[model samples]
Target: MTTTAVEHGPTMNTTATAVPRSSVGLVPATATLARQKISAAIRSGDVIFAVFGPVVFFLCFYTPLHRQFELGGGDYAQFLTPIILLQAGLFTAITATETAGQDARAGVHERMMSLPIPRVAPFLGRMAWVVVRMVLTLGGGLAIGCALGFRFQGTIVETFSFVLLVVVFGSALSMVTDAIGTVARNSVSIASVLMIPQLILVMESTGLVAAQAFPDWVQPFVRNQPMSVYADTLRALASGSAVEPLAVLLWSVALLAIGVTAIVVAGRAQVKR
Candidate 1:
């Protein structure tokens, strides 16, 4: 009787809503972002730069240097082709600065942080363009080099090695430059600053001239520097001659380590805002 007289209380709903898993995976997000970057590069004439940058550089170097190299009993086209391929990678790195700077200025990274997709997707997307640009530039550079009498005297494996070396160096350089672009306040200024070192390294390297070609005082720096080592290694690969593979491997590893370090440091240094 007392229970019946008690006032009835309202029922509380105990049903819980299941949280949904994310529909977008990291791979798809990275691919989508990469496509976006590639498209932007196309719209901005970056594609043209990728294909023609090496062509212009090749002509500039070869036109003046060919007779000189030939006079010295060497084919400049063969001697110089490897460096042009490597420079294509350098060009790619420089271009990455502008695009990465644009993204930083646009608040794209901040927007990305709010999404469920992996944060690294956007960076990986930008790197995909680096590979594409390097490839395009390599192809164009090779075509021009071949037209000018550059030939691969190496076996298929060595030729492949030659190519792999160029791409790897370019990729490492791109990674460093891209990270710089992302973190630097003024990417265009960064590019200009890099150009000086680029010119110095290429000009002083055995790629453009023999170690003996430089003055005795600078020869020590010119002969053993990283660019010179890379140039010498690439020449060996193209000529099907033996080189210290361990040295090239060490250089590659060092370059890659520097690149990865740059990316990680830049990511940590980046402001999510």
Candidate 2:
């Protein structure tokens, strides 16, 4: 009778298996991706272009124009430094459009979606790499500027502030281009679509020539456009004067919002496909 104990099935282990924590945060992961992107750019010779492009432009324009024209009563090269820096950022931003377009055309985004990583990681990674290139371009431009008699008339803080403004604006513009690239048919198409607007902005802005220099018909547009505002603010940062920083800030925010919306739309479209 006592031996009638029910046979026990396999006893379950009540110990909870601990889930291992991931050591990487978004910053580190994004940084790793940034490094990878930068390495790829270096391998592709993008670094060379980023470094030398501003130098060449500086040589071509600054050398010939410096003695002929004095802007704001200072050397033209000094006056042109801000614009040169801005141009470097612009050129670096172009890579974003090309790379994003290529990724979209190649179905790279689709493959990335299958991975365990965050969806935004790739985009942020590309942006981080863009910043790296921006820095390089800035450095190269500054070096060339220095070589060509461009000096910072402002204090060190002012110079740094000028750099910050340029980089931030460039980054905003890059995000806009990134979104455009995601939807564009190809890199060439992205370039074609962006070229006219960018050219207009650069050529008509107060960075290269005074707003007063523009024809009467175009002066109104040149004086009030976002690019003109940015160039004016940057010029002020260089030598100190009245500038419309608020306008540039608002414009940057608007561009960033548009870019984010475009990326979301493009991502949804990709998912549908």
Candidate 3:
């Protein structure tokens, strides 16, 4: 017998190859999570609150105050629409922050960390729902505004762009709130920390009133702050005028950076623990 003829063939590996994760799955997963979150908000009656708050403000505050005070020409309702929409956005952010803080304190992050899903998925899902809530609130406010004589004087494109800007501003504000939420000890702390600054900015800025209407000592701050700049830009966009976009851009970028940094830091700290 020839020993060379008895040589065995090379062995084949029996282990199965692991399949790579598909990016396509991420979209549906994120969307599903966002929908679930939004449904929860609806069940909690937050959706009703978000949609109605602006309408109430428009009816009670803007309607009466616009008549009592000159609001830089045009229908006062038109002048006040942007601010109402902006306020609605801010309210959405506040709600988001409170929810996020509650989740963090309840150890939701810890549970999430054990899952195979991407780390940012939950945040993105919450933000997606925030945008949805904002749209609903803004839509409700716009209907109320129209009933009160608010009209879009600009082209359809400009009108859409104005809405887009409000959404962008709201999204940026939400990020900042999200950052605060991630690290805050509780919902009350989140509210207390954010409410004062929000009031100072929105009330003192050109949102509700013109810079000239403010006291001379505060005129400079009112004229130059991010909220004022945003309001001015949105006003111009709505009425078809020159927009100074720099200030709004800078504010959005700066806040987004801070928000991202805070979230990352908080997440890392949580993970380490």
After superposition on all CA atoms, what RMSD does each candidate show versus the true structure? 4.1, 4.7, 5.6
- Cand. 2 Cα-lDDT: 0.79
Ranking by TM-score: 1, 3, 2
Q: Which model scores highest in lDDT?
A: 1
Model 3, 129-242: lDDT tens per residue? Answer: 888888988888889988988777788888888888888878877877876787777766777777778777888888777788888999999988877887787788878877
Worst 10 residues of 2 by lDDT: 20-29
Q: What is the per-residue lDDT of model 2 for residues 9-124, given as tens digits with 9 covering 90 to 100?
A: 99999999998654455777688778888898989999998888888877877776676576446678767777777777777667789988888888878877776567787789
lDDT of 2 at 248: 78
Give the poorly placed runs of model 2, Cα more than 4 Å off: 1-25, 71-73
The TM-score measured for candidate 2 stands at 0.85
- TM-score pick, better of 1 and 2: 1
Between candidates 2 and 3, the one scoring higher on lDDT is 3
> Which segments of model 1 are wrong by more than 4 Å?
1-23, 271-273
Please report how far candidate 2 places residue 127 from its true position, in Å. 0.2
Work out the TM-score per prediction.
Answer: 0.90, 0.85, 0.86
Misplaced by over 4 Å in model 3 are 1-24, 70-73
